[model samples]
Target chain A: MIWLVWRQHRKQALFALAALAALAALVVPTGLTMRGAFADLGLPDCVRTLGKAGPANNETCLTAFQQFNDEYQGFLLVGILFLVLPLLVGLFWGAPLVAREVEHGTHRLVWTQGVSRRQWALAKFGLVGAATLVIAVGYGLGIGWWLGPLNSAGQRNRFDPLFFDMQGAVPVGYTLFAVALGILVGTVWPRVLPAMAGTLVGFLGLRVVLATLARPRYLPAETLTFPIQGTAVAPRETASDWVLASGVRNASGELVVRGGSIECPPNATGPGAAGCGTGLGVEPGAYNWQLYQPADRFWLFQGIETGIFVALAVLLVYLAVRRIRRIA
Target chain B: METALETDQLGKRYGNTWALRDCSLHLPAGRIAALVGPNGAGKSTLLHMAVGLLRPDAGTVRVFGETPYDNTAALAEIGFVAQDTPLYRDFTAGELVTMGGKLNRRWDGTLARTRLAQLGIPPDKPVGKLSGGQRAQVALALALAKRPRLLLLDEPVASLDPLARREFLQALMGSVAESGTTVLLSSHLLADLERVCDYLIVLHGARVRLVGPVEDLVAEHRQLVGPRHGDDPIPGVASVVRASHTDRQSTLLVRTDGPIGDTSWAAHEVTLEDVILGYLADGDRPTSNEAWGVPA
Candidate 1:
């Protein structure tokens, strides 16, 4: 099924990848130049800089950094590819999932071929999932060179809320989430515009509402449980406070950080697909932070987010399968 | 006992409305059965259920005496040509054939190519570019190449023009005749069904209103020509569907098995169209020997 899905959308996948390649080519020179400028400075020799507190220098430096961040982030392009391109592609890609058959009333032909409804659904999902995965992996690899320089810069200036901060791996993750959502919407709702609009509205709406309502409570730091240094990673052991630092895509398509340092709370009914501390959330608690690293929190966040999105994706596929069964 | 296709009280419901009801049917091997129905008549749903695309809300469906769903071995014996002659709009005919060939174990690629060539449908041509008739032919080739024991179609001719529809149906009939595959096809046009189908099943309101050999049904059904005045008794003829007259002459569409006893009315052969209208128009059920058709 994934093979068919891959074949059907192979062109679009290649095109998105080609665009990513072009972006990489355009940005690699600038990244190299930034590396050269640092080497020329020869002061503290490539230390992460806290820029001087002067408006003119700050503006120019920040602008330069932002351009590099834009390339490394690639959210604007990747997100559009995942969210918007799919809706149009769903017209071509997802439409045949069942819509055109319904429109032409031709599903009857295939339905009678003795292949069960479940097998049919499985095949289509396999195909579309493969295509979406290929596009995502391409984005991840293509942007690696541009982002590596920044990581090597060992930059620790937290003031510049640039592209890489919010729209990094987070957007790539979110885009896959959107693609899965589009597949379900396209299959069930069927008509092109309505399916696209409903998907856009519903996805944005739910993610925003969840972010707004759940953001503060989800981080572990607010719970104030003492930072128990990785005690064998076992649950049911009364685990300590953990922080949830989120880089969320907002309604206007801008990436923003929602929470500061927060505490983790213990939830009994944790994320169904186990791992990466999905069960840990935050509220006002008894522990305080000593020195917390954002990278630790980043791991926990990505793990939880991946589990959540994957669960949601699996659920969407299940619903689509059921809907298709009932279609005939 | 091992029928090619059988349904035991098979029914499909869309929420509160029943698409098919009490549709118990059995098709033995090597019979070409035409499922005739009006639009919205559960024919497609029935076919879907037969092929295991849709589960029956109640009762059971089997192909080759085995449940089609989840029975890959059983499914291997069936080839379906869906309504509207559907194919992956993205694939060229050749690619699709290759895909189908790779997927099915019993594929006969040589035969498929020959059929495509004979039908004058270029395998390199994208199905999207082909005419409706040509696409239908391509679909037929693909299905035939599977070498299935049972072949199913749902309104495969609905999109084609009148002449193309006839040509496609002829080709389908020829295949069935040549191979002796058990065939079940659904359509709205009874004239074509009558032409090619040896067995007939009339579907309406999710029920099997009538089913039997076409010849038997036609032979037994007769239109009675009688005068208007007499309220005469008729033997062998079971029911009168409609009666009308001008002055002294009267015409009656009645169903009968043998010689009519009504002295006042003369019996005449009924057209297949009239017999079909009787079913579509929602009249009496035609018994095996009963014939109630009006001559036009």
Candidate 2:
């Protein structure tokens, strides 16, 4: 059974290897260059001292950080490749696993062999699932290593959706989910092209819904209140925190308006703007509030999201196995 | 005789229509049975059930007295070449043979290779690149290598040209002779199975219409020509399978238990093809003798 699985999917496995090598070709050199620039600019020391330094030294650190961001920001496009890798695995490797067999009527041939259909399905899923896991973990670690300098320089937050999805254990979860979804869709649909299309739509749709509607709500966001001024107070070390919402709140805790800025009279200027707040029926206790998930929750969030996706993958695989058994 | 495959009151349905219904028959050991029917006569359905590819909705299908559905032991003993003889197009013939060897517990790699060599089939060429006849032969070789006790073929020669059909059957017969395997070969064309099969099962309207030894089926059915009489029963003619009438002449294909003794009728011997056609034509009528509890 193992030999048969390899014989059937060896081409797809080779294709995945080539794709991984191609991705490596793009990331390896760029990662080295970014790391070199990080060391050259002494950005590591600068980031460590950013909030604690005197005004003059702080200015220098900000300038160095700005330069690093300007130089390496374009490389963020490589993250898109990592983002799409799992989807490609779903379509090319997973969608056609069972679909092509049924479409070509080869399932009838293989199922009637000495091995039962259930065994055939399990062997394919086991081998393919293990391969996806290895590839996804390897890719995730590679992305983590490549993005280390940028993330350390405080140019991008690890909590950001793009970076979060591409790094840590979540990519492995995504890959497993995508592959399992592809298999389940193919088993139910029994046509390669349509199953691939369905997998694409389902995977992307669930991702969008989860990222937008469910991620921020994974845990109750912490809120901070500060005096209303020219702008909301910038926390000393919030570079890695995910700010979900920030707005002005009145004394009664009702949101007066939903923005970091407060409008003032045209005649009011400089210090006079402080008095403008009272003219608008704003109480003296009115303050700005920021809702955020702290940087300390990064690993917690990764575990949560990974748990969600992995659970979904397991469910999809179970359903696919059940469906394959009942198929005529 | 030991039974190789048997189905009791087996039935299957798709949507609102039954693809096969009340299908019950037995293929004894070492007999090549022809499952003959028209295109929609449920021949494929029955073969699929026997191989456990399809689960019967009503009754049971057993191979060597063991239920075949999801039973690895039963599956190991049944070889099936589905319609069109589907194979992995990307693999070469040799690779397919290797795959078969890897997948089956009892494999005869030497027989597969030797047969392909004798047929002059290039083992290294991808099966998709082979001619339709070569593909069918490769499929047959793969199935034969399993050394299965029962081989079920569904419309194996339906798409082959006459010469290719003959060659494919010849290869199958050669292997069968060597293995003494019980074979159930299905086809809409009677001529394909007439020469090779000693037993026959005729399916029509998703039901088994006739089943027996080929010679016995041919012997019991005869065409009787006599004076036209409106719905009149004839002595020694047990049941009318098919009938046609002109102004003063009535010709009826009838099944009987004994030789026709009435001198008013001239009984002519019928071929296997004639018997099959008679049963198939009988399918279109509102009523049949089999429906009336007459033994088929």
Candidate 3:
């Protein structure tokens, strides 16, 4: 089944491999050493800027060694890449698995062939599902090896939440989640381009809203909003912001914060809180909000969240299978 | 009569409009039946019911004396060819044949191979690249390779050219003759239908208008040309499918069990197309001729 699915999607596989290979070759230097200029251009300067660059470093060997040991934040890019395309495949490629047949009335031929609708749908889902798993793992392994040096160097650098949460097993988990989301969207909207746009728009919207609503400026625990002195946005969006970090919990526990700094509202009562009701308060710690460290709780929360999304995916798939089977 | 497929007053409604109403058909084994109608005549709906694709709001469809759904053993007795003949564009002909072979228990790989070869679909050619006519042939091959007891086809040749459609029907009839398989195919081309179909079902306005053996139907109905007497009906005429009159003469398409004894109207033998168009015209009228249980 997977072989069939892969055969159909060999074009995408080839494209992904080509992209990865080209990037790898562009970065390669003689003997694949840290002495290469590509190494300096990619991370050495960035590490020095972070005040963590080591001298005359065998960074390639370090990078190669750290590929497994150190968590590569760049693996998140792999997640983003896998996240976007498979979703497209699901919408454009997978959506037509049944709906197109029914739309064109070809499903009737397949339907009457003594193969139950359940079996038919199962074959498609099983095949595509396996393909997704393989793609996620392959991508995860490749990026983990390629960007090892940056991750090891960044361990000494200031807290960069993007790279911080991207290491180890988390990127793989997130990519799978995104792919599942894409599949679910495909099931819901079976027309090719519409499903693709819908998945992108819907997921992007949800991510944006979640990021905003869970931020300290929008809503804080006990306090309506944070009372930070000034907005502390980074020069680049890639710069680590403590407030919007993923795996971070919300004050109300209803949601999770992704990353960004939030500006606060006034205090509720007492001391400086007396001026809070009548005035636009400027005092720091007037409604003090604390940021939590990434801990066991964070991973537990991540696991729980990914599990819920996966469950939703499974339910959508079940409904889709039933729908396709009901087609005569 | 012992029937291979039977529908007991099957009815289906989509929202406010009824797509099929009280449609009853009994097709016996080893007969080539054709379901004929104009567009939106409930032909597709009725076929869907027979194949267990759609559930009737009222009544039932039984295949080989049982429902065709979920019952794998029951379905194994049937193969279907649907209209539009759509295939996965990315898959090659070889892959599709392989798929059919793997999925079906009674699959005849030799038949698929032979048919595919005869159809001239090379092994590596993508289904997407095949022309409309070639795709239809591949679809037919897929259906026949199952070695079904009963074959249900919905408008299998609606899009094919004259030669290709003729070839499809001929090949199908040839296979049926060899295997004694009961085939039910739907098509709009009367000439092709006349050549192959022994049994006929005419559907109009979501209802079965007329059904019987082709020979009997052709024998009973006649294209009569004569002067109209609005006050006096034709002698022994069961039903007038359509009536159009000029000042000097009237033409009445009449269907009767026996001959209508009207010397004034020259009883000309009706072609299959005339028979089909007649029923369609009858079903189109603000009908009061509800001798059968046709819904109001």
Best model per TM-score: 2
Interface RMSD for candidates 1 onward, in order? 3.2, 1.0, 2.4
CAPRI-style docking class of model 2 based on DockQ: medium
Number of the top candidate by DockQ?
Answer: 2
Off by over 4 Å in 3: A1-96, A99-106, A138-188, A214-296, B119-121, B224-227, B231-235, B259-266, B282-296
Indicate the residue-level lDDT of B82 in model 2: 95
Alpha-carbon lDDT, every model = 0.64, 0.87, 0.64
Once superposed on the true structure, which residue ranges of model 2 sit more than 4 Å away at CA?
A: A51-57, A152-155, A229-233, A236-238, A261-283, B282-296
Model 3 lDDT on a 0 to 1 scale: 0.64
lDDT of 1 by residue, B261-285 (tens): 7577688898777876776785454
For residues A1-328, write the lDDT of model 1, one tens digit per residue. 3455466667866876676577567656765765564444442222233222322334544455455455444433442343343234334344345565565554554454435557766776776666666655555444444444454332322111222223235444545566567667766876656666666776677666654554334454332223222222212101111223432222343333343322233433336743323244322222222322233354455456556666777787777777776665
- TM-scores, one per candidate: 0.75, 0.93, 0.74
Poorest stretch of ten by lDDT in candidate 2 chain B: B282-291
Candidate 1 segments whose C-alpha is farther than 4 A from its true place: A1-3, A38-120, A137-168, A221-296, B227-233, B243-250, B282-296
Number of clashes recorded per candidate:
26, 0, 9
